[model samples]
Target chain A: MVSKRMRVAANVKRGPYATLTLQGEVIPSHPGQFYMLRGEWGISPLLGRPISILGEDLARSEIRFLVKAVGEGSRLLHALKPGETVQATGPLGNHFPLSGWDPQSPVVLVGGGVGVPPMAYLARRLSENGAGVIFCQGARTKEDLLLLDEIQETGVTPHIATDDGSAGEKGLVTGLLERELEYQPGAVFACGPEAMLRAVARLCRGKVPCYVSLEAAMGCGYGVCLSCVTRVKEAGKVVNQRVCKEGPVFEAEALPWL
Target chain B: MAVNLAVKVGTLLLKNPVMLASGCCGYALEMGEFFDLSLLGGYCLKGLCAGGSEGNPPPRLCETPGGLINSIGLQNIGIEEFLREKAPKLRRVNSVMVANFYGHSVEEYAAAAEKLQAEPCIAALEMNISCPNVKTGGIAFGTDPKLVHEVTAACRKATRKPLWVKLTPNVTDITETARAAEAGGADALSCINTYPAMAIDVEKRAFKINTRSGGLSGPAIKPLAVRAVHLVSKAVKIPVVGIGGISTWADAVEFMLAGAAAVQVGTALFSNPNAPLEILKGMEEYCIRHGFKDVADLVGAARDFERPDCNLPSAVIVTGEKVRK
Candidate 1:
């Protein structure tokens, strides 16, 4: 819950995206967890921008964030230099359920565009734990795919799909997801645009248990503001759950995605 | 000697003049992980109603130059659930706890107050008449002087605990409403809730907030809030609790000088969870440096000093040994 001004160890740009490695005390975070980051910019953009945890190296006491120059905040983040500092408050929100997972069964992961980074962290963690991992990555073209070599270095080759047919499969990522479901994965985890998450929820509906990470424009990346909420069904009644607190990760069946 | 930071609002006594504003601090338990709640003078809990409310739809907030507009619709777990879940945890915190209640009608406000009246942990009740998100009974009761009196009078009968009526800033003259609340037997007043405002995404051709409009809070509203507190405190005889965009200790001092007995921190908690405690420390330093033994000496210090002829003595009293003018 503390907001610290951490120096940037590295800001590496790869095509349209960038990765920022922050130097600070090690923050214990799991996959799908996020942090709210803001630059020294003035109050024009009053609140901090919510960024997912791409990876962390506790040995170096550094955390990495994979950012795309989508808006004012992200654009500022991408332009950060090596010595510049940024304010960060985190390890906020829920994380992916990896502890309860059975090691003998295969785990399927679905991610798209900016959503692909956490999957890389999840894949490496699951693989180190002696569980089989399969990753399905989606993008607009070959150049749009993120962290392929990094993910492949983890000893798992990703099943990639490109919409323009310039890469592995020539359709939506869900097309490859259907093929992966045939092997009967023990659990399915996904993070992406809402449409893709809905499709994945539909594909994994009754066949296997699934968890999806949701995104919302947040004022405070904590429980106080009540800004980031998703409608969830509990006991036949739909209630708005704070996405920053109760979840950024939720069971697919618990969500009313139609 | 240590500075006496304590202040009284009706029957409730605060350890200091800094309190966490409602809707920004949640139930206090969520923030307990960051700092000790006992460091604060008090904290006003989120607004509650007779029944559970789901609040407004998502895209509930947007940022302005120096503030935020939010239409959260007062989403809460109802009084029964709050009593069962949050009150027990709040009871353990060593600070004054004020329950903020709101409803769609006067009767509903009374009913909610009655439910919280028996809770030993709750030191007082604040009736929220300034919530801009609800469709009825919120800003409606706060705008008109008669409606303000009606709602306060109804709740006055419901609870024996001290009642503090929170006023809306979206009015022609806030003094009218302040006087009305005092006439209705309110023990204290909390002036200047968020102003009704909106933001739009011109590129997308849509409102930035889901509810089309929301309440504005932060540094942008501080000057306006100080003016409201000054006017309302002058118009009413009851104590005034100033709130609206108080982020720093200097801001809290400005409110006290303008006649607020205490001040509340709202949107600043989103950025810094320890704002109330920070303000409290700064206030103590300010009192010691100014050679004041008590923080209450600063309240209403600027009320009549601004007048051109205020320094002139109207009457001269002659004592036995010396003439004191």
Candidate 2:
């Protein structure tokens, strides 16, 4: 619920993407949660862009975001110089489920492009909790495979894929996921493009429990605006749930993916 | 010098003139996590209808330059659920709570109002006749003067609570509806709901919002809203509560001068959750600077101006005359 101006500690660019490190009195947050980040002042781009909580260090009060320079809002975030501040309002939406998870069975995490950041943090937490973790990431090219070193630091080697045959597996990351599902992983956690998520949901439908983090164009990142609603089936009836409020995370079985 | 921020919308007395608009403020309780709800003069909770509504589909919002078009379609958990889950929590917050309700038909509107009238936490009721997102009920009930009067009268008979009719900007003359509502016994009027607007993604070659068109709100519509508030205020004896792209205290003051007794902050809360309080502080400072004893004194403060005749040179009329029928 905290929204304040945090100084840009660093901006590490990887081609069209950038991992922004911000330092301040960070809001307490978990993996898969996000902040609505924006410039200190502007009305042209009205709403704050919702950026996932890629990483955090509560002791140092530092937070990180994986931003893609795709539009006006993210471009503004990527172009920020160190020492400049951006308004960060966050710890919003539900986080990845961690409790009651068995450490004996392996946990598989799927991330694509900018979606890799949250999974990296999730992998670290699961590994720390004595769980065997497998991280899979996909990108357009070898250069787009983000946070290889970071994911490795969590003591898990990310199974990588590139669309152009420029990386580990020369195909979609879902191919890697399909291969791993054979081993009967305990759970599948994912965050990525809708098409990728749909594939993950389909692959894990009856085999293992699956969870996904969703994104939408939001007005107010709170419940009020109702801008970020997505359809989810509950009690045999389909209903709209706000991605910012009801969840950015939901069980795969509930989503009616086409 | 002490300044009184309190203002009256008919019989309903708000601590200040700044309240969050309906639809923009949710149920008025979700924001308690960010700040104290009591800081606002009042907040009109999201529009509720009979049996509740599921709202519109995803891709519900599209951002335009300095504005946003939303087609939330009046989603709610139903009045029974609100009373069961949210109302108990709402009772704890010390602020004016305005329950905004709508219906697919006039009887539905009355039933929803009557259902909400028993809640002690609700200080007033804002009947939404102007939501542009829905297909049948909302804006359809707002565009015509006869329908506006009919619906207002139905709701007026349903509840003794201070009734405010939220007018739609989609109408040709906003004043016509304003007069009709007043004649039908509306205690107050909320001038100008979001303008019916649309946007398209040129790359995708598709409508940005699933509803195709949505209600546009934000700073882009503020001027048009201010003009509507002025016209509506003059047309009706009831107080006008201005709503549109009011983001700052100066904007609120502008509305007051244009004839609104109170103002609502809607889209600005998306960008800055603290906008209402900041606008409240700014309004207080503005009053202090102007040596006004009360915020109510600022209402309708703008003086009438003489129309200046335009005397353009003959050379400027060349294309105008040439294109004549």
Candidate 3:
């Protein structure tokens, strides 16, 4: 089938990147999946890059993304004006299984830099599910804090951190998470740089249930190119798992730390 | 009436010859939504090894004029996990799935094959003789015909499924290696794997891809791969599947005419997830248009007294000395 081609409803500059909210109707109950977007659409490059779903309003029929301009594709995506049409194939990949959480458990949402996008979607769902969600967001500077108000609407108490001490508490998001461990909730959900994930994995080691969304330059946003594989050690054996297939979100213990 | 683009190699058959090549197609089951993967003839998953391994560090890819160089280092989910997690999905696909296996030692190839041969989804197994030989101590299995025969024979003995030995073109007289593999009891052949290649960045004064070297593929290697298929087809009775730089249906047709039973799609998928389907359709239409009932009849029919027109150099070319030594 031809992939769903949509238009950019709005574009907002956040920190060092830009977030384009595409006009596509994905229900809030979607459990969150990614969209494969093309910057310069058509036959130029056959593969469409995968972008995470940040938040969507079912009534409004709009999906949001928090993206940083890091490469040629992102640069072109960021340069587009609002209402410009770009091709998007989504809500692709598997959705997070939120069955493990309970009402009494402390659900921690840890996000570092741009890895923070999907956490917004997860946090919204956890709040709706009565998981007592604690949203921890981290970025390099003050300008990187995104969707603070949107997060608050979900009844999540937002904790912030910056690399240069420009926001809530200086240091890493894991540092802020260390302080919030006092909540002693049920589980943790995080998305961010690989190094920060390793740090969070170490901090939550055997302490609580943790899940992290992984990022890789995907050729086919679905799971064709085994390029997005991440290693996980299970039962004393290591296995390479596709970040897009088995998960864009995997249990912290289940992750094969690269 | 619909044209039949599926390719049949011995008892094994493909819905279409445009298959997703290993390292290009992760695990067959999880890739369906992106491209309706069921449409392809078959899928060759990322090379699985006996022991779990972490591939080379990133910046694993760099683009060329009409192709790419990748040093993915055979990243796989290992045999056990694949069986438990990816097998069910693979079995569900209408197309074929050929598990691509590589090992540092002959024993590992046998063991990895043993693990996959049990799964009904696996229609065949393709052995990458190009993988570094950690045993006999540290040489690539593909570069030597002796090791090629040994690995292929060991794998063939371990499984009843069709055995395909994927020969690398980084050798002198590829036909000699094809003969060795046939002697080793391979059911068929896929010639050739991407030739060993590299790239350099003029500004940084350094290599573009990680590992400082990688496998070059896409349109650039099509001519060479076609030649390899044509030569190997004449030299051996076992079927040959052509792979390299095939981006369109015309390329697939060219390989078939040159004596390839089927074709594999790798770097091309990096650009279009649905390209395999398009190529498959195009092939079927081409056959019908030419008054042919099945394209299999076209294999190797293009042979003439004069050589085929190919853009690749008549001889293999190398950039510099090996540093990994």
TM-score of chain B of each: 0.93, 0.93, 0.89
Fnat values, candidates in order: 0.62, 0.78, 0.31
Q: List, residue by residue over A1-258, the lDDT tens digit for candidate 3.
A: 235556789988764577788786454434447877775443334445678888777677787887778765676777777878766666766666676766677778888777767788888887787677788898888877877887888888789888899988888788888877666767777788888888888887777777777877666666665556667666788666666666787777877543
Residue pairs with backbone overlap in model 1:
none
Candidate 2: C-alpha lDDT? 0.88
Mind giving the per-residue lDDT tens digits that candidate 3 earns over B178-292? 9999999998998778767788989799887668777777788888888889888888889998888777899989999988998888777655556677788788888888887
Q: What is the alpha-carbon lDDT for the whole of candidate 3?
A: 0.75
CA lDDT of each prediction against the hidden true structure: 0.88, 0.88, 0.75
Candidate 2 lDDT, tens digit per residue, B219-287? 999999988898887777889999989998999999999899999999998878888888999999999
Q: Which residue ranges in model 1 land beyond 4 Å of their true spot?
A: A99-102, B303-325
TM-score of 3: 0.75
- Leading candidate by TM-score: 2
Q: How is the predicted docking of candidate 2 categorized under the CAPRI scheme?
A: medium
List TM-scores for all candidates, in order.
0.92, 0.94, 0.75
Ranking of all predicted structures according to DockQ, beginning with the best and ending with the worst: 2, 1, 3
Best by DockQ: 2
